[model samples]
Target: MPGRIDARLQELGLTLPVAAKPIANYVPTVRTGNLLVVSGQVPMRDGVIAYTGKLGAGVGMDDAQAAAQLCLVNVLAQAKAALDGDLDRVVRVVRLGGFIACLPEFTAMAMAMNGASDLAVAVFGEAGRHARSTIGVPALPGDAAVEVEAIFEVA
Candidate 1:
């Protein structure tokens, strides 16, 4: 049977993609004690980076937000893999770290990150309310418009 989180995803018309392989030597996730730390995920879909370019440049606010949401979906995919496909093992969403690739003039990092935050809450309800840090950078891996990493407390 599907878990609550899976059902929620279905209801929202969101489907987690296959977890992407690490581009470098680092693993996708690490579990220590009760916490699972997921590496930063870009907006990859169909085996390629779906959203690229810097915000305030070619990437618009809508696409940036979509990229953030996609990154969160990838993060959840990694977390599910780490927890042996049982997202219900997740006890709490501890934190989310967002990186927005943007030009120097861009200042909407927090608003862009809300794409991921809102979905996190939508999927996990109160358990998804988490501490977060959003940063603006000149570039990110694969030049993705947005990247998101997560710390999950699991059973």
Candidate 2:
């Protein structure tokens, strides 16, 4: 049976991917006390980088937003793994950090990150409303259009 969070994800037509392996030496997630820190996740779907390139140069606003959402999905996957597949163990989404690969003139980084932030609120309800920071970067790993990282309060 699916837990509440999992059910919400299904209702939203989103399926968590297999937790992605760390591209470098760091682990995907770390749990200490009641907090789970998830590493930055890119827009990967089914083991492939789904969105790449600079946001202002090639990727449009809608596509960048979708990429941000995909990054959140991967973040949840890592959280699920840390909680033994029980997403309900998550009590709160404490914070989210969004990295946007874009041109120097691109100023919609916040709007792009809203894709992930809005989905988080939808999935977790009030618990998903969280502190967030969005940054414009020249590039990200895999040249991904966006990357997202999270801090979760878990039971």
Candidate 3:
């Protein structure tokens, strides 16, 4: 039988992609005690960056938000892999770190990050209400519009 988290994902029509491999030297996730830390994930789909460019330049608000949501999806993929494919092992969403690639004048970082936050709560309920940090950056790996990383407390 599918776990609660898996059922929730299906109910929401969200399908996590395969966990992405590290592009650099670091592993995708590291577990120390009950804490699982997921490295930053960009908006990659089918092995390619799905969203690119700075937010205030060519990317619109909706696309930037979608990019943020996709980043979270990737983060969840890594977490699922680390937990033996059982998302129900997650106890709490400790924190989320978001980086938005945007022009210097852009100041909608919070709005963009809401994409991930909303989805997190949707997927994990109260456990997904987490502390978060969102910042605007000049660029990110693969020139992705957004990147998200997370720390999860697991069983």
**Model 2 clashing residue pairs (backbone):** none
Among all windows of ten consecutive residues in candidate 2, which has the lowest summed lDDT? 14-23
Q: Which regions of candidate 2 fall more than 4 Å away from where they truly are? A: none
* Candidate 1 stretches greater than 4 Å from native: none
TM-score of each: 0.98, 0.98, 0.99
Q: Model 3, stretches more than 4 Å misplaced?
A: none
Identify the superior model by lDDT, candidate 1 or candidate 2. 2
Question: Per-residue lDDT tens digits of candidate 1, residues 1-155?
Answer: 99988888999999888888999989999999999999999999999899999988989888988999999999999998888898999999999999999999999899999999999999999999999999999999888999999999999
Clashes of each: 0, 0, 0
TM for candidate 2 is 0.98
Worst 10 residues of 3 by lDDT: 60-69
A best-first ranking of the candidates according to their lDDT comes to: 3, 2, 1
Candidate No. with top lDDT: 3
What lDDT does model 1 reach?
0.94
Q: How high is the lDDT of residue 97 in model 1?
A: 99
Of candidates 3 and 2, the better by lDDT: 3
Q: How do the residues 1-155 of candidate 3 rate in per-residue lDDT, one tens digit apiece?
A: 99999999999999999999899999999999999999999999999999999988999999988999999999999999999999999999999999999999999999999999999999999999999999999999988999999999999
